[model samples]
Target: MKYPLFITQHGELKRESNSLVFSGELIKKAIPLAQISEIHCLARVSLTSGAIDILSEKSIPVHFYTTKGDYKGSFINDASPRGKLHLKQAEHYLNPEKRAYIAQQMVQGIQNNMAFTLSRWGINPVKLNSISVEGSSMEELMGIEAQLWNLYYAYFGEVLGVKDFKRTRRPPEDEINALISYGNGVVYGLALSSVLKAGLDPSIGFLHEPSEKRYSLALDIADVFKPLYVFSTIKALIKNKVMKRSDFSRNKNSVYLSREGKRKFLEALTDTLRRTVYYKPWRRSMSYRFMMDYEARRLVRHLKGKSKYKAFKPWWR
Candidate 1:
């Protein structure tokens, strides 16, 4: 199976035949086109237009992130040029009723996944009952999700061996918050690549209103997987002693991971993607990465009216 390629160093990516060659101070490596399903640049990385052409031709999306693992944007070659799928997607967004339904589904998915995570860690997810998606307004849904996540994250502090923690951003105030900020970026890159594979217009979304250079569809998808893929992985890493406080560096109030810390997180993320889980409908196991692309295709079917949209829920072991 093909895997997403992540470059965590300051490197130059160039095209070499049907492959990508990376030249950097510490490492010079070549990656065949077939082995790379997607690409994520985690730090200062440069790519030539020739390399971009190759990736575009292959329909592979490349996501760019800051050295701090904040999402910058993505290079997704527009392969779906105002086709039938795009029309349906636009129609759904334009119709307030349809848009509201999808928004509800997205929030429901996120809340359900959060509850599942808490349950798996032996916490009572019943606290999520305080929030609901019964209203029409997007504000209600967003508010409900926020409240539910507050409870969910409260449990995360216990599972990850942290205390009295609150999720913060904009130069994360603490190490835990810094890790979450970084991990969310990881999941967003995965979501965008999946959207590209499904030929969906990431800008036109069901939940978030489309904004300049913001892939709102990816934002919607990332919400569902964050609890399962990103947060779960972080919890396991810290709880199992794979990562420790020394991995992070704090300058004043700004908390960030060092290069070695970044490498360890990426390696753990790779393992999380490769790990298999039972897919209830298929009754077979698939990797987390494959499931993400499959979910994107499922969304396309839902938009086409061929099937109803269903959120991905963890079938815990």
Candidate 2:
């Protein structure tokens, strides 16, 4: 099965025959092109022109992150563009009522998954009774989302026994925040891959305003899955004490996962993505990774007027 290729070492990637080869100071490895779903460079990794050619030809994205795991950008090859579908997607964004509906559903999905996840962890989530989207402005909806996440963070810290588990970014202040930042970056890349697969313009978003500097649509979609994927991975790691103190490094007040810590987190996340859960629509088990793609397709169907868009909740829900 194709899996995301994570380059954690400073290396140079080159195309050797039909495979991609990574050569570093102490290590060299060749990977079959077909086995890679996407490429993520968490370290300084340079891609040769030939490697770029094949990757673009294969329509695979290469995401880059800083040493602190902050997303820099991506090299995306849009090999296929659905012109009509894109126009429809833009229409949803342009129409205030339609944009409000999609944004509300996305937030609702985040709230439901947060509650369900907390309950599964033996914590009672705070009820969000005040979040009604009807006749609500975009700012109000965004404020509600902020409120929900703040509650989630409180519960998350409480359950994990992390003192003051506040959310921080741009070099997270605490260990929990560090893990969250890194994990969210990974999920953002995955969400972008899903969006591209559905042929949707990643820059056109409903919840987050579209900006030329970032793919805001991926950010919108990533929020829905972060509670399920990123938080769960952090919880498991902390609960089992899988990460060691050496797995982290500190630079003044900012904390970051060491290279070892990143590998551990990625391994656990890969397993989580591979684990199958029953999908009600298909009546069969599907991987979380597959579900991400399906979630994007659901939006496409909604835009095409084939069906109404509802954010993905757990099958049990």
Candidate 3:
């Protein structure tokens, strides 16, 4: 099975015949080009021009990050298509009908995600009086989202390992929040890589409007998968003592992932996605990457009118 390549070492990447090699101080090896979905160069990493050419030919984007774990910029050889897609999104946003359609899709995606998560714990969330999907329009969907947020937090104290972890929104003010956010970022990167491979326009999304530097569709899709991918991983990691309170930093204002914490968190999340899990919607088992790619393909179908787009429903059986 293919894997997302995380190049954490400071090195220069080169495209050798049929494979890619990373060589520099403290790093030397050939990466399997076929298996790499995306190349995440964390901290200081250099890439040769040949490596860029190979990755561009495969439509693989190299994501760069600063030493502080902040995102730098994505390297892609082509820019025209992304530019045109951005224009399309601006036009859609200007039209009321198109904007409404996109808003509905985003809400549907989040709603489906919440419903699926609740069902896993044998809870019928759709029947909850606290949660009501009133009205039929996009505006009403926001109301549904607010209700789901309440319901989601209510279950935090009940979920296995997290029962003891306090629930807080915004920056999560606690150790648990830091772990969750770190894991969520990993899942987002994984989903983004899959979306790129599917040839979908990540910048033109159904839920998130076009932005100057953000990929909104990736964020939308990541929302549906985060509870499944990130939350699940955190549960396992905490249960197994793979993470500790030292993995985070907190001030009165906010809590955040430490550098070492993020490294371990991403490592755990990557392993979780690599492990095959049975998905009820698909019947047969599939990897997390395959599920992400499938969702991207579904979006393309929605665009082509080949099939109606159904936001991914998290499965539990």
TM-score of 3: 0.79
lDDT of 1 by residue, 105-169 (tens): 88888887888878788887666855667554877777777787788888888777678878888
lDDT of 3 by residue, 1-317 (tens): 56677665667888787677888677689887778768777646787888887888876788887644445777875533544445554566577666566566656666666666556656677444344343346566656656665666566445653454556656667777766655565556766766676666677665555687767778767776776677667767776888667777877867787766776777877787787768666677777767777887776665555776665655545
TM match of model 1 to true structure: 0.90
Clashes of 2: 0
TM-score for each model: 0.90, 0.90, 0.79
Candidates in descending lDDT order: 2, 1, 3
Task: Report clash pairs, candidate 3.
Answer: none
- Please list the C-alpha lDDT of all candidates, in the order they appear: 0.82, 0.85, 0.67
Worst 10 residues of 3 by lDDT: 126-135
Q: Pick by lDDT: which candidate is best?
A: 2
Q: List, residue by residue over 204-308, the lDDT tens digit for candidate 2.
A: 989989888778999999999998889888998888889998988999999999999998998888877777777666778877777778889999999999999
TM-score sort, best first: 2, 1, 3
lDDT of 2: 0.85
Evaluation by TM-score, superior candidate among 2 and 3: 2
